[model samples]
Target: MRGVGIEVNEEKVGRTMEVDEKSVSGTRFCLLLSPDRMRGSLCLRLERFRPRLGSLPGRRQRVCAQRRSPRARRETSPARWRLKRMSPSPAVVVLALLLAQHPSADTLRVPLDYTSIQEAIVAADDGDTVLVWPGTYNERVDFLGKAVAVVGREGAQVTVIDGGGSGPVVTFGSAEPPGARLEGFTVMNGNYNVQLRGGGILCSAGATPVLIHNIVSDNVANYSGGGIACLGSSPFIIANTIVRNRARPFGAIGDGLGGGIACDGGAPTIVANVIEENIAGGTGLSGGGGIACYGGSHPRIDNNAIRHNVAWSTYGLAWGGGVFCTDASHPNITGNSLLENHVQSQTVEEGGAIYCFDSSSPLIRENAIRGHTSGSGGAVHTSNGSEPTLVLNNIEGNDPYGLVNDEPGVTLCAVNNWWGAVSGPYHPETNPGGDGDPVSDGVAFAPWLASAERLVFVRGWPEACRVRQGGDLRVELAVFNRMPGFQRFWFVTSVDLPGGASFGPLAGPTPLMLLPDGMMSGILGHAIPPDAPTGLWTYHASIGIPPHDTLDHAQFDFEVTAAVQRLLRSRSLDCLFPSP
Candidate 1:
């Protein structure tokens, strides 16, 4: 194929030309014109003679030469037609198909085998995926400015960052829209595990929220939250086993708080996690053996197994064995099993299971508490005018050292606790009462203390039940009437008598406070008024035999037919009714 360039010269149009390269390149048409558009009338005439060139100058060569054309008085400028070989349509279609087959989320993937986790993070663009492979990257990683998803393969031990040294393992501080997501990795060893402020792993005031899962354990915090710390951020600590993290102070008052994790003022959800064997050791004032909730931080500690931890006198004063909620911080302590927790020192003021003070009312209920020890409450204690501590369904063992409430107006109303020696107002044997049928043969009826095992017998009497005139009369009744253990007895009475017949100075119900014998009796003396009328009168009485420690009810009915019968009987009754 061949082509030629016929330069056109006209007065109004610049020296312009057209090139048709179908002969040399074997396809298509070509065109070129002067660089200057002004005085462009002459350049338009050159289009009439469509010239072609066999070879066109390169772009660099076309700019160098420019001359005025004499033919037809044309304006000359630099613009040339350059042509090269072009590919067929079938070849262009094949290249686009290859790129579409590869997988990508509007970005690229970088492996951790050859590069560092921080290097992959920094090199990634927004919306890219950095697939980290299996290996330990023993260094602190910070998500510099990328809003990318940095994930690792499952069972791929790719990025194993430690707390051995060099500050927090990962940090996220950026102005991106929606922060970041961290999943499928084992994060351990650091002064603090994952610290982020807003952007990625927030440690800042308005840094973004974090979602943590899959075992964050054995981490230490010099201040609080040994496993993870969300300073002012609210993170969702969901379904993770946070175990054995210690928070001890090296400087200042080492008031260690929250061994497993300490959330300071940040309202995070600590749900369904097993927080145990965690110690908050202090040299001075420590709190929350398993988890400490302080500083007006209201955290909901629900449905977790907080057991076998020690919040004791590690320092001068220690408190909160299983969980410590103080400082007027109202945490909802519900559905948690707080068992076998110990507050060893009397100097540790409150709560073997929980210590509440300073007007903080935490809802403590439905928890199985046992084998716990402290100065006051085996279960719980409150003080500082913090009235109405709601405690319900907590099991109390006879802990020699248990919960104590020293403040006035502190009401601890406990119910349904299963221990023989529970200290309260009601006696264990007297509860589950049987109306005057007191001989209950249950194990709970045994002596409350080992030293005093007094006999409690069933008092059975007053069966028919009728009385009047204050039932001032006395009667004697006995059961197994001559029992040897019951050597002494007393008369107790109830009567229905007319108003005129007065049983003067009638016997009281407990007049015979102790009846040592089985048979003993007292008189029911009556005074008949001189002008009294006739009326039907009935008398009933019973005997309380203290030896048997039982009441024997016997009914004795008699009608005072007339006033004369009572007057005559009073004189005759002296002979029949002798004080027995």
Candidate 2:
């Protein structure tokens, strides 16, 4: 026979619990394995209450227009019918009473004359719904501690929620546990639109929220967090298009950051969102034209198109044109396309596409960056006491300048990066510039060009690129085809031998061909070492031609991957918050 024992200990402030249980086989369960941790009270409150209805008497249902007598009930028993008619309609009275209390939860159809959504909220309950037709509403709404859904009707078109408020018009505050969700809405306008304070729509104060299939755009912020400000929370800002959000005046006197989404301290998952054309302006130190991070916030920025945004010298000294991270804020940025972001300010000196500074390091990987420029890193810049940045699996186009690491011990390592139109060993032997030009200053002009013969040299070389211990190994190439006409080529791979470590016969002479229109392909081939080394070993790759080809020498540098490097050196997987 099994026996169970329970004990309750009361404390001054709260209650404590203890439990012991024995199985039929005479095994005793420890107090730590008690259900106290698993047992929690679930409080479910109805946003709106509805009353149930009962049957009516035939005497009460009198005959009218096409009438004869009230028939059966009138003929059967008049006295009983009169008694039944005198009885109160409990259902209607109860329903009216319930409706008076929590008005939001009861389901009510949208009135025909209800032109504004704000009016509907004022009349609804927590679980109530408002099915709006295709039209635009220019008003601000505040969901004060209610959980309601406002959805569009079938075939609804051009339905817009234009907030006329000064700052974040549509607000959602949940009084429940945590992790609320909001789906299917388009919001626009206001100085800084769609501001989510404590727990905005689809956001919870203590738990993660889900926001999906929405469009938030064309908003302005005088300080930080231009379009949608996600603060002290982890929410899914997924499958939404956030565009044209701007942080104006450059935050000359304030902590101006995150033009698109300013994540102060919390890490939120921003996945598969089209974040484009957002601006962070400053003559000096304004960051994250599209997205920025500060105050030890690291987010996972993945699978989004962050393109055509500008962060430049409104007054000069603009920091991040595309994305910026400072103050030990590390973000994981991967699988995004950062294209054609311009940082052309008179005082701009750092990164054009990305700027990492002040001991903050992020992981950047598998991103396509093209046509971005700054005085230092035309693609990426790390300055003023920053640390190791990993650059991997990126097609870095012509920006005249690549990476700038000015401090002595600040290591800037890049491998397997397709330096567009630049060739060589990837670094300067003595004092070579970004393009192996040998004369690159932190300011003035960036010399991002290289010849196949004048390979840019990495000072520490293979030390900067390596795989993790007991992990899978990969060899990625960012080969650039420089020839004018149709050209055919391949990659010859090799690995550096440290002490006794060695690898051999790298998949003999694969084939790659490119046309004149500058369309690039072929980043294929998998190198997983079944028995990889425990420490650093550089995998060197070179482009070559088959013995029967005409062109003798034509090849460029490829991208690299160091396991879990910081953000600035990353070529893929950049974002904020937790994602699956």
Candidate 3:
């Protein structure tokens, strides 16, 4: 696909891939993708043996962890990763996959080796890597189903792919694999004139490219998928900011589709993304301001923040301001925060957050659907033989009702949800004194939870290991919750030294609510006696609520050399060299 760079500029940052530190200093590091050598699943680093002659190609080396400088750590906010400071994007390990080192495949640079990005892609092979510098390219690009990787030199902030108000900015049509990626660029100014769908990007014919760490915004489509559209393709869309896109229908009134992302018979994995401020403008019928799944698609939408999107039907009806699924689509909606989304219409507005129709059965679980507004179903609605299941969700603070079912003989299996209060949702015929949000008749709300866990423990790792002789080897767990929710959690860790001595049941200083989208990172660690052991220190760290419920945990080991204030680097490279 399109993205990744092998540039040698300091201010114009390349994708800082982490390779093993063969030497401490006086070494040069660069990354490359060689499909014939790296087994099509790994990225090989090209360490320049002679740092003075970096421009000339020399012998290649594959060191695992690169040394992180203070400036690099400042550029990337979090120092959680032991490898060279990764980009601040979520799941930085999965950004641009420059797979196996091929001897023949080269790193083609935009405006350096080639004039444009499409020319580089055309002249490239399956194992090639196309590097785009930080500049606005006013042309369209297609992957051509090759295994190439294209990455922005300075990430998405400066690297732009503007379509110049023409067709889709990017297209992946020919069935690419998972390793084919498009990363680190801002895609905008895409205007699809005809009803062909996919204003910003299009993926069709079973294409499965990994689209991560990019900004897809300010695009307009005549039909569906204003930001990104998938027709019979299952792309991995992760950690991208998708905003300000629209589906206008060319001043027409009636269209039922997605504004930000639409999947037509595609089972795409959409995770860890922020989809906001997208609009579906129509009159009679419209759906999904943030996302739409129809025609038997089964997308996995997990751990995303979908807010402020609008499904507007000028004077008619609309459904699902956050997500809509129809025509037998069965999406797995898990661990997401859907807030402040709206379904706007003068007449009817159903499903302020989610809607299912015509046999669409989505598994909505572990999500916080809050602050949505609609006339009918404020949280969710089901109709026309749809049998959706809702579990472990915090459904609260919507305008009218929490759950509504329009079709007869179709009971929604909505159970074990927290409805803004310990007393559960307010139902006149069932629980009149319920202090939570309101629920309509024919919707199940029993077996509900007293309180829901506010944050999904995205992941946890040791930011640093506090080590002092005879003191404690305390591990700090930095937990990042991407959703706009709150929960108080504490920490405990157990360390097993190299000599079989046990240390800790160590606890954090105080418990605090990890609140409101990256504001607070939780703490977890172990207190090990440093003077006792010297070989290998294995630690297990965990974070949890006050009494019970371990939210997240990480197990890792750090090497112990000599005991004379020696620095120990971690050997466990799970965060660095993940399984292919």
Candidate 4:
């Protein structure tokens, strides 16, 4: 008797097998195997077999096997193997011949098997993943048109890809498909002067790669897109923090722009990113400190926090501190928080939050655009035949006018927006008489919203007050809701007291059911410790409805002083006298 062992890891296959032999003729035997009805080991018995003749010397033998499932029958090919049923229900079949095949994908590890990322990629085949360890790699890597995933084994916080301040950090060409992905790395310090595109990442010639959960920061480009540049490619850029990059000067003119991200002639999805503190357009028509979309590129800019970006031009006009769109590029700008973006220029500048020129009709909706500072259009500037649809946005607290139109003939359709008030607060630039009334000069505003969908305004009394040591301090706040519907809100109040003294919650995350246009007043009291140092303490109040969406934030400062004898004596006297 002879035996063989085979191990199967799949749940559908049996675990063990046994075989027994019996001789029928000289140098010939018959082999038989018995398979259990369900979930047991496969048994094999050989009765007769021929070795030298290369065929069975007697009649042809049949082997019985049971089908595992209905899906298993389809997995067995009919051309190489034939099955004849021995029974009808729960069929046990006799197989003449069978062949099985198995295939596996590979995970190429970096530094363990290969010394560098590019080496592993070169040795890898299609559908392979290169796993990088947590370490700083100072090299410029290119995808080389391979469908693979280059991912960090750790997270983005530790896995670093430093570019050494030259060339593109990562490049993807037309041969790369959307399956090629770059994830979980800090791509920084790339400096490309001659190419002038994509200091951090470059996707060109219809290459669609997935870039997610990365930090692309502190890169420099001479022409455009210090952080990332896309030329005729649609990349999925999601959930990244792109900050502090610089786009220096245009190559000639009308080219260098988009300090954070630049898109040309492709539709990319940029969602849920934090793009802040980028500088674009140092000279020669610089624009789009946060993002620039040109050459009929349609990008979806949604649910991102774009703040603290600056755009300026020395020779040509500067547009869009937060975002600049030109050349018939239609972008859907929605559900974003644009705050504190500034624009500066010697020539004409426009759009602290957004600038649209050359007939780019973008749908600007449901965004909170506040605290933008610029020469014109503190919230939005539309000029040169660009007509954007502004609807359902909270356009408030922008310096120098909410919306600006540079041309008198092209009118802007701004409807159903809250401009810090219910009516009559918008200042259009084209108004010839310049009287802050509701008038249209190439701008149409009205049929305005009666109330905002979500509004919270907070203020504190006694903005600057001196409280003695071990004294009781009280901070009061008035929160207003202007939503048209009745909803429940949660309020939180905190303080940054001096000397590391903690402030306990006096009231809230307390729920309050507020009606439309209703107001709620609450007080937070703190007992100053005797050992607390004398300094300025900050008090903050925030209101929101669940899951970390803060609708309003207010902060004020107050001074803490040592105990005064005279003030304590006056307080004691007032308590004893008891005002009647």
Specify the highest-lDDT model's number.
3
- 340-383 per-residue lDDT for model 2 (tens digits): 66676665556777888887778776555556776655567777
Clashes of 1: 45
**Ranking of all candidate structures by their TM-score, best first:** 3, 4, 2, 1
lDDT for 415 (candidate 3)? 84
Score each candidate by Cα lDDT. 0.43, 0.47, 0.68, 0.64
Better model by TM-score: candidate 2 vs candidate 3: 3
Window of ten residues with lowest summed lDDT in model 2: 42-51
Models ranked on lDDT = 3, 4, 2, 1
TM-score of 3: 0.70
Model 2: residue 461 alpha-carbon error in angstroms: 41
| Residue 147, model 3, lDDT | 75
Q: Model 1, which residues run further than 4 Å from truth? A: 1-114, 120-132, 142-152, 155-159, 170-179, 192-208, 344-346, 375-377, 385-403, 412-580
lDDT of 4 by residue, 1-580 (tens): 1111111113233112121212312111111111111111111111111122224345342222222334544554331112222121100010000000001336778889888888888887655667788899888889988766687767566888999987889899755775577877899999897855888999998887778668999998877888999989878786678999988864565445899999988988786567889989765677889999998998988767687898988767778999999999999987676777888888777788898999888999877777778775546888787888888887777777778777667777887777667554445453333322232356676666766646444434421144666655554454543333344555555566676454533233433343333333332345566776778776666666554666665565666666552121011111111111
Candidate 4 off by > 4 Å: 1-103, 250-255, 427-440, 455-580
